[model samples]
Target: MANVDQDSNLDGATEGSSNANAPLKRNSDDPGWNCGTLCDPLNKDAIKCKLCGFICKAGITRLKYHVSGLKGNGVAICKNASKEDKAVCVALLENPKEDKIAKRKREEEMRAEVEIEVEDNEFYAGSKKKRRSNLRPLDKFTNPINPEGPFLNMRQQNLLDALSKERTHSVHQFCARWMYESGVPFHSIDNDAFEKFVEAVGQYGRGYCPPSQYLLREPLLKEEVERTKGLLKKQEEESACNGCSVMIDGWTDRKRRSIMNFCVNSKEGTTFHSSIECSTDSHTGQFIFDYVDKCIEDVGAQNVIQVVTDNAANNLAAAKLLIEKRPNMFWTSCAAYTIDLMLEAIGKEGKFKEWIAKAKNLTIFIYAHHWTLALMRKFTKCKDIVRPGVTRFATTFLTLQSLMEKQEKLKTYVY
Candidate 1:
């Protein structure tokens, strides 16, 4: 009997040992188990990474860190893990609790929707009619349904509630001040792209950083160029359908380099074709003719209806050459330039020449002295004496007109 009892005790001990050595069964939904396997049956914390084949002594969290390729977590990252797998692990690590809460909320909402739909179907199928309320239809005027507007989701409502008039005004003032300080054009705020950019920034919420200078100059610039090309292509197609006018103009930049701009104008709009630097080449008829011919070729000679240029001798010669080559297209002088020449001739007259010289001297003197300028502004109520125009000669006449209009104020200030 003692031998049989000893045998039963040994059998129970062996069964208990086997149970202790059994592998732990983890939750099937755990993402950590997908990337690793149990290294030891008894030790639940020990896991072998399938990616790098490294055995980690820590728990599932450490195994996730390894799969996520995160450093400084007392575990080596999985070198063999792909970017997609690493991203999954990183997202899980960052917002595990938030993800769970969101999932639960979504499930509850779906269940509620299904219940409401079922109830609606049953109510519609039933023979009984809906009960009439005690309140009259006219009573709705006093107690309106959603007087503010339609109902919004919780997140949208929160965002709208947070954006008060005062906060919006403050943000506007801050942006305006930055643009003013940076010398950005005031009209830039009116651009559709600027409005969209502001909308995008607002949508991103807080903790969003602006693009770096390198991105702005390189990638963003290239993207903008490509977009502009697409828009110009549409314009070019329209121009091809309805012939375009080729306009050429030359100007000296701040660096004293002569630049010739070629533009194509159609019923759609004007598109800048190209710019050629002519600092090395003389302003000869042959040079102008060659440049204009090249531009016409690029724009498709068949699409060009007319060539327009200033009334300069070289431009006239170039126009003649263009007419000879392309008899179909006409050559015309710029009306604005012709008017500017007439204004220049009038300014050079004896009577007007002296008057303009005196006016120019007076303006120079008043602008040169801060005290005089301030006094003039104080007397004129901040009105300026100079009036800019399209051309230099036109500007002179406009300035004279402005001075005449403020003559009484000037007299008062001078006294």
Candidate 2:
């Protein structure tokens, strides 16, 4: 502590203290600081305002303004002080000491709060600092903690810390699988509302940490494998020696990847057999024949009765090749494909094309605006227009039929 004599000088106050933890010497020039009364001088760094006999904490710089006749800093103006100091103080009532120390302290606290908010956001979005917590297996965490402890037996935070990398990764996989299967956008995790939800869980229900998409893929895949195996086992047990029919179809998905899907029907059940991505291979008769042959062999050719495929020329040729190899089973074209093709041929006639064109225009316009669609649904008691099916032939007739059914509602909505 620097000794302060009656003379007003701050030369000694600035010396002998380069350490940050050292008590700050009062700057005499500060609007709130000055000498105390002679009887109890220094006042252990308290501000002794003789005018109002007010004494406050040492660094309450605001008090200096009050003693100087200022009315800010949550203090009233003192009745005493020279007329000159009073004049200067009155103009500064709205603005008290803009002290660097107090400003810096407030700034630091604000920054800390901002940092906590950032961390919370990152956690909910399944993005976090790479720092490892010494978390143990959740098997241990399942046990209740000692109620007598200050907090829960194992602090939720300790549990968070205890999580091993593997367990954390599994949790991440769980979250990812949930979103992917539900068709949620991958970036939804980064939304502010999502962050608030995770933060709420942490604050109220116990801390929750979300997992990432990549983390979820592995576990969900394993689960899918097990689930498929279970289904296959059940089907095998239920199936009798009765003949089974296999149906196969080839198409490109929205992603433009070629896929071949197979299904089997029997006394057991109609079950999806498998799907193969054949993007790289040509969809020729030979390719289709080989796959059909493999399917028959795998399901036991002795129990196979027939095979079905769409009426594509390639599919028809492939079926012929398949039957030649295994004369035990017959190949058939799908009735649904035949119906769709017949409808398409009818729609292609010039007389029908006029009506189809008009229907297509109306559907295109109605679907373009969500509000218009909603209005149409309301008038029709909330039934949406039939969505276009995969095949143009089917889609056209289906939509036309729907338009015909809702003709009155469509007229009402149009006007």
Could you tell me the lDDT of residue 398 within candidate 1? 98
Residue lDDT tens for model 1, 1-415: 9999999899878866875665443434677788887877578888888888898887888888999998898899888999998998998898976888997686445333432122322221123554322333333223222313432211111122243565445456667887999999999986656654554444432222467788889998999999999988877898789889999999999999999999999988898989989999999998999999999999999899999999899998888888889899989989999999999999999999999999999999999999989989998779899999989989999999999977856866875
The lDDT of model 1 is 0.77
Q: What is the C-alpha lDDT of each candidate?
A: 0.77, 0.65
Ten residues in a row with the worst lDDT in model 2? Answer: 115-124
* Candidate 1 TM-score versus the reference: 0.58
- Which regions of candidate 2 deviate over 4 angstroms? 1-224, 238-240, 349-351, 365-386
TM-score of 2: 0.46
Q: Write the per-residue lDDT of candidate 2 for residues 1-415, one digit (tens) a residue.
A: 2455623245333432332233333423444334232223345446556556676554445555665664445766666677766655554443544565676576445433432333222332344544333334563446443323543333232214344665455446656887989999989986655544444443322334444576568876788789888877756654545567889978788999999998888776888887899999989999989888888778877777889998788888897887788887888888888888889889989999999998878877877988888888888778877757868788888888888867756766775
